[model samples]
Target: MNDDSRKAGGADQDPFFMRDPEKLAANLARTIEEAGKAAGFWSRARESGMVSDSSFDPFADMLRVFSALGQYWFSEPSRSFEAQTRLFTAYMGVWMRSMQELTGQAEPDKPEAKRPDKRFHDPEWVQNPFFSSLRQIYEVTARWAEELVERADTLDDLTRLKARFYVRQIIDAMAPTNFVVTNPAVLRETLKSNGDNLVRGMQMFAEDLREGGGIPRLRQSDLGAFEVGENLATTPGKVVARNDLAEIIQYAPSTGKVLKRPLLIVPPWINKFYILDLNEKRSFIRWAVSQGHTVFVISWANPDERHRDKDWDAYIGEGIEFALDTIKARTGEDEVNAIGYCVGGTLLSAALALMAETGDQRIASATLLTTQVDFADAGDLKVFIDEEQLQALEEAMERKGYLEGGRIAMAFNMLRARDLIWPYVVNNYMRGEPPLPFDMLYWNSDSTNLAAANHSYYLRNCYLENNLARGRAELRGRKLRLSSVKIPIFNLATADDHIAPALSVYNGSRLFGGPVEFVLSGSGHIAGVVNPPAQRKYRYWIGEVHEEGFERWLETAEETEGSWWPHWQQWIEAQGNETVAARSFGPDEEALDDAPGKYVRKRV
Candidate 1:
């Protein structure tokens, strides 16, 4: 038997190998022999199926043959041939060394010498007469097939006799490059505009290629600091309350007596809360402020190892609970509207559940954006949540005391390997492109680590067991059930979202026994929420609340187009008082400078 086959067996005995050698060898031989037989059979079958004197188009056949040859040459196996050869040689050497050690023939502590260098140019092993003859035969056959394909004249002849063989090769040769169809004049103008710029771009791409890969530049010209209009009146806004980890930033109308209640915005700790209040034109928070409604947003403190034991419960207790009481103290109101995004929404749901169990109906309304409650259908995250993978992750986090943001980013990148990995590799390394500076990519790269305890618990309980969906998730010895929360809910989901698929986000509606307005928006997870009114490309779908299963709701829901944000704004406004007011839920603290507080400046 061949060496590759002979070495395939008893791989389990050697954990690394994990296969049987003799069986593997036999299989390989059988496969090669069968492939040869199949090729011959197909050739005969084709001849038998065709009528005699069938128009033989040698040109078309030649093209097919050449294309096939090119394809074979450029395929993954061919590209990786040298690397695979080196890997196999190294593996064999390691195995030999291991066996020698086991037999007491080699000293365990002795390091082996470096392997001798070998080159494909050498005429040692490959100089065999048998191999030379086989190589000649292969070349001749390939050439003859190519000549046959290329000689074909008619399209019909090519299609019937030679198209399949050559088409694949043509595709392979053209595959790596991206092509955009446009007017020839426009294309030519674009190419000629700046030769120097093109040269520089190519050089930069080459540099990136050498470095490994390049990141795509996200459009950031439209993004900047918040800009409030001159006509917009400034209001009396303050930090109505401060907690152990956060401060509530509240804004109210400057000219009027305040409404009794207020709106509370809960943003995910993963990013700064400023996303809602980005600028005058796009800021949803600022828009709410302009509408004269009382607004209070939770600013989460940046955490470190000192906060290692802080879990979901602490977030609810010190974060949301603290803010709720502070708002109450400022306004003297028992209930207020709450809006939560992503992880914040998750925590809000839990808090609402806890409050319901204790008969505390303090939440007048609830809005969840891109939040997940039922993790059973959490989508792409499923790849990394298996028991063994989780255990390995836990061990890794245990070593570091926390899970680094970089590790989390890596996991996310894996989900979109082609877009995230391959494009970068080709652009940076092969095409020689420069690094593109993009704010979105920058923020995405700016990851925050998760505490070991919190991460482990979240993965095991929420993701693996789907505990929240099953009503088995517990916090602080209190059973947290989604059904307990009966408040009016506005749930927003995004199409083209990778993190939370729209259907999965709709699960929140089923989990909560309340009036639900499921709104589907255009764009991805982040962009969908950050969508400004001026952008014309986006659209949304509004579905009536259905108490039935997520699948059933989808079946019954009608499709619509346009931004869901407007619908959301209208719905949320309807639930609250329409009159203008300078409202505060609790007593104000010492004045804080602006909307985005100190917590946002903290490094992730």
Candidate 2:
């Protein structure tokens, strides 16, 4: 290669740049052999009845979408003609633009009028005629496909929602940026490295497939850089209690005077509890401790097949209730304030109902962060929940005795594939580059398997049936009603949350038979909730719950600058600001482990 080629292929331009044609060919051959081996392994597993045929098929919802589209198109010839004409018209515009550009007669495209897309941000995507046309073609086709689903009036609301979601996934997967030939960046890297990038990418692909046990598990972060207690979950605390379902960590006080009423945090079992204790800078646990409150976080056990029968009853009884009992024992306080995030918040809400029924009043006030008791409008996550899909999921979970953690991770990733999946694919596989070490991404990648009974109940009652909202949800042979739980409740919802919509959370706030304070935070699920006052990023809104709707309430709500952490602190303090000398795990108390306990360290 000449000096110009070397300059183009420099390490500064492409991190994975290397000049070794022999090694590239060898790596390519090995990758091909690995692919063949993986195919054979899957084929043999299927033949042996270890894997079902349906497992090999694409998502059934995708097929249902095509079926619906086919019915719509075949119902009338002009319907199909109209769709084709629309697509062709879009193509004609692209072709004319390309020709105009080629002849130096084209006017600049209206960038502001176009949809904001990160994938097409590369200058070559617009400057190069070939790539510009390809980008236009993909965008046009994607829009057309979505329009067909929207126009299919015969399909029901749920089916149409699923169709639109699946259609987006399909279109996203087919984006020009995902392919080597069409992506200028990847193509440039390929040329610069003399196919070395592809060779390394293939190797990485094979490794991921191997690690995932035949499934491609793309690395979201540099896993080697972060560990649970060492760097990520480095909060100072002690495991004061351990049960089959969880370990209760009582965080060491950062202040001399702590709140008399200790605070217990219930985190989602789907992922590690350390999300709240990621690092010193971002650790909510540490921050809460510093805010003159005794913090106790539930570190849920990463369950396996042995925990298959552990249901919501077990989680509540052996998890939340157990923590309450422990807090009372250690602190000599019965009235403890509590906060729950995501599914943990949902589980806590149910437990509160159960507790109300039994006349157990250990909890004085409740704070639910981005929780949805009513799943009617549970955002895009609902697309994966239907009768057929639920049954399939149940059967699969039954076989393994637990649902694979990666399944949940992949579902969330798909909801934003353009950001999560494809970007990682292009970066890690296409470019043969390692993902940057990020604490949040590290926590996201660290998934936890869900016990069969617990997971099944959550899906059916919460997602599919929307039982909790309707007062039909049951726990421990008793029907639990949200209205029965009359306690001071703080309900928080993120404006841009995808898993739990802000409007759904707003509606849920009305379900609780209590004085509810609904707060709207500025970002999505994790960032919005974990936001610290120190960061001074993102705004929050507080307002009276409007009978009209969330949007109406937003119009009249009081907007406050910076993180919601300080506001929440003030609210909790309002509950009861009386403080006492800080408490710690006594020498006599049995300590199972340090903070960021063993349960979180258990890999799925």
Candidate 3:
């Protein structure tokens, strides 16, 4: 606990360290050397375009942001002076507080004044004077840097977003908790284990680097704890059909009789479809079946170079349309209810427009879960959609034919790096502990690749150009318009969603020509939509859709406790409540595979 004790390698406190410091030191040195070699290999691979996507240098953008900030501040001498004085004043306050603490003259910080940070939850961070001061300094510096960006009024909206985002990244990366010596939890573990934790951690670091094929894929959950069909995606079903882009999985009937209009689920291709079917307890597909709805899900293929030419047209034609045709063939049904999650909903909306143009009316109703048809109010994800980044991304996809799943996974993880990236970094690499087995995290880790043409078109039309909402989007040489799609829509948006902001989803709801019932749910992108009624977690809002604005709608909306599953089921049944005998896959339509088809099983 003292300087001398620390300098003596905490040997007096650690029996293992006191007994054999030399052996521990030797092992630490060797492991660190091996880790260095692995890091060197990763660096080389990134340089050679094996790990990284393309020449999209994020650092260049960061520099541009700072340059704008510098120019704005320096434009006026008073402004520059004020900025410096403000930062220094904050530092002075920190120093004064630390002095007071050391002299035992400090009053306890008010609970309201004490900003709760999960990273500094360890008692030592508050109890130890040095760590307490260190935390205050980090907080001060981070706030100052963020304020600099916020005050840079000269920067454009996109540039400001990028600056804020990049600054947060830097501040988070520099946090004391990330480092071993500064992190009391890791330090205690290290001293207790006599440096053995470091050795094991470095070994894992090297192994993960190797597994990633030059990129360090941090394990967010115990990889061996769950498998696709065994425990995770265990819903009973049969793969009724397969094509170039997807497999249509029709789940077995849980009830003797099912709804007349079957339900089809289209999940985002960015990740596997099993998020909705993680287990019996949380499986939406199973829940739907139990509620007397015959469910069919589209399991998109994990693409490769061969799929590089596959564009939006290919996805709509082979994925959505193909599933539609298969669903009709399997069940002697002419119409069906459909649900699309995230980007899949975007694609489905486009397909519906195309179907409208061509007078195809098989889809009776649609449920969009955390989906964004209009990207104007899209959140932090918009930071990655500018022209420069798109070109760089396109170049990378051009070389690889398909964008790697790991790259997509990394981008989403980076959006919430504090929760997703750094905690795993400190636990896996510093404390030397494997992540707990979380089915949601496991599903997140299991990402899927995107074809070059598909990803490019999506970025350009949806995020970059905002063409989908603008009615300028085209699919397969036909102009697609959301207004043309007249089917009733159940639009669900999560209050805390980062990928698809609720406001954006609300804005998108107005674009539909038919009656749109916009529902707001608690939690985020994944949890909000996958919520089953039995859990009794999170709430949902329902009321008349206010076309004016989301705030106006919320003002009149009635909030309900528990999941929105029952509400959704009621809506779907209201459309066509007829009862039919539970149907099985026809003998003509032979089973391609078991439920959670082979396509979902493919890993990048």
Best by TM-score: 3
Best by lDDT: 3
lDDT, residue 212, candidate 1: 21
TM-score pick, better of 1 and 3: 3
lDDT of each: 0.59, 0.85, 0.87
lDDT of 1 by residue, 102-208 (tens): 56687442211352212111231133222223233333344443443453333343242334333423432232222211112222222333222233334443332
For model 2, residues 1-604, the per-residue Cα lDDT tens digits are: 3335647767655433455668657766765775676576556655765445474234766887689878988789998899889999999998998899888898635333547888888876676677778888888899898899888989987878888888899999999999987898998887666666776777777777666555567799998999888998898888989988889999888888999999999999888888888888888888899988899999988988899999999999999999999998889998999999999999999999999989999999999999999998887888888887888888888887888777778888888888889999999888989899998998898888899999989999999999999999999778889999898999999988988899999999999998899999999989998898889899999999868987799899999999988888888988899999999667676687888789889775
Off by over 4 Å in 3: 1-21, 43-49, 52-54, 108-115, 585-589
Off by over 4 Å in 2: 1-31, 37-58, 108-114, 587-590
Error of 3 at 102 (Å): 1.6
**Cα-based TM-score, every candidate:** 0.60, 0.94, 0.95
For residues 12-50, what per-residue lDDT tens digits would candidate 3 score against the true structure? 564223456787688689778978978887888878767
Better of 1 and 3 by lDDT: 3
lDDT of 1: 0.59
RMSD of 3: 2.6
Candidate 2 vs candidate 3: the lDDT winner is: 3
Question: Positional deviation of 244 in candidate 1, in angstroms?
Answer: 4.6
Clashes of 1: 46
